[model samples]
Target: MTLSFQRIAYEALNVCNGVTMAALEAAVERTGLAPGAAAIDIGTGNAAVAVRLAERFGLRVTAIEFDPVMADLARQRIDAAGAGAEVTLAVAGAADVLARSAPVDLIVALGTTNVTGEGRPTPEAGFTALRRKLRPGGWLLWGDIVWLAEPPAPLRQITEATNLYTDDAGWRAAATGAGFEVITGRISDPAEFEAYPRDAVTAVRAWLEAHPDAPEAASIRFHADRVQAITDFGRDYIGFGVYLLRNPD
Candidate 1:
């Protein structure tokens, strides 16, 4: 599962998820986890959030990304930040890390809803598995696609194939069902939501232009076109949101 284009696109994007830096930092502040607490950022694209956590919030962060390409970039980013000791980059699947690790103070899974589960990822599967990775009262900063309006069958079929999506209420229910207490959740600003795919498409286009003869150009373009089309079509029915949840104290 190498998304080479994603690495290039992330160079131009803020975070892999549609989450803004300000919003994620705010969500971290909401966690109220003190300095020196432990945190793991699953599917941490470029490990930007992880680096921020270790540097600003004084967290001992384990930034996880399975893609070697992205993980390499994250490793370089972490090393250059002089946060080598504070931020540990793990090039492994989230579920693998979660299974073996001790409970931490916070777990941040943004955009990568499949942080847990085998087949199609769902909120319930993710929440349940993640519960074991945190201590009581620990936080889960989760962000993913939410159905703003009922999607057409065609779009729904396409969306669910990658990762299961649901409305805001559906997400809250899944969290509570998995024993997490929902603290707060926010639907993204329309403009911010709009930037996600647009930024990716723009970056990919630029990369393709620069590397026109590259062997992977075709694959990258195909992915970019598919994503751009789907995103454009689904904009009316789907939106992104971040939810802050906590394990029972």
Candidate 2:
């Protein structure tokens, strides 16, 4: 099905996925982390969460991304924030990056697993990979889109075909099996969003306008279109999810 487009405004602030930045700040405050705590954000796109953790809680971050383009953008953002040293943007997948890194106090894989592109990797395996990198009692914050109802055939086909996703319960079960205790889970409140797919669309549009002759414009346009389609259907049938899981202390 065809989808219309929306322009993203750079002036618009990014909204946190499910948990607001304020809530994340509160979590840090409650934890009473020392001046230099460590955190990792798996599949971190543009390092938004990593930047938030550092700026809000004074934590150092290791932001991992497999996509070079996205990782480069994140690196630019981190550097521009004057936080280059504070946040390390690793251009590697979760298993590769986490394996070499030290155990972190927190790991966030927000909206990442869906695109892992390998049958969702069984949440059990995903958690097992993450568990190795988490310090005992460290927290893992996972976020993704889940079906609000049995999705229409088109949406299901799009998701399954792309390895995108729709299994909130399965994630909970996997976390449980992986020895993680769920501390909390919540659907994202629209109010908390700062940066969004709209911004992404805008980014793509601007790139198209500037580089009209560029060879990659078609691919970029296609991505923007897909994002717009998902956004259009998301409100009614798809909900973004976030789960805060912890290793037993």
lDDT value, candidate 2, whole model: 0.68
**Alpha carbon lDDT of residue 80, candidate 2?**
80
TM of each candidate vs. truth? 0.96, 0.81
Error of 1 at 194 (Å): 1.3
TM-score for candidate 2, residues paired by index: 0.81
Q: Kindly list the per-residue Cα lDDT of model 1 for residues 1-249, writing each as its tens digit.
A: 354778888877768777688898998898878899999999888888899999889999999998899998898889989999999988888888888899999998887845664866668988898988989889999999999999999999987876888999999999999999999999998889888889989999988999898888999999898889888899899889899999998
Candidate 1 displacement at residue 221 in angstroms: 0.3
Best by lDDT: 1
Off by over 4 Å in 1: 1-3
What tens digits encode model 2's per-residue C-alpha lDDT throughout 187-231? Answer: 656644323665657766876788777666676677778868877
Mark the regions of model 2 whose C-alpha exceeds 4 Å error after superposition.
1-20, 26-31, 114-119, 161-164, 190-195
> Which 10-residue window of candidate 2 scores lowest in summed lDDT?
1-10
Clashing pairs in 2: 13-194, 14-194, 14-195, 15-193, 15-194, 15-195, 111-143
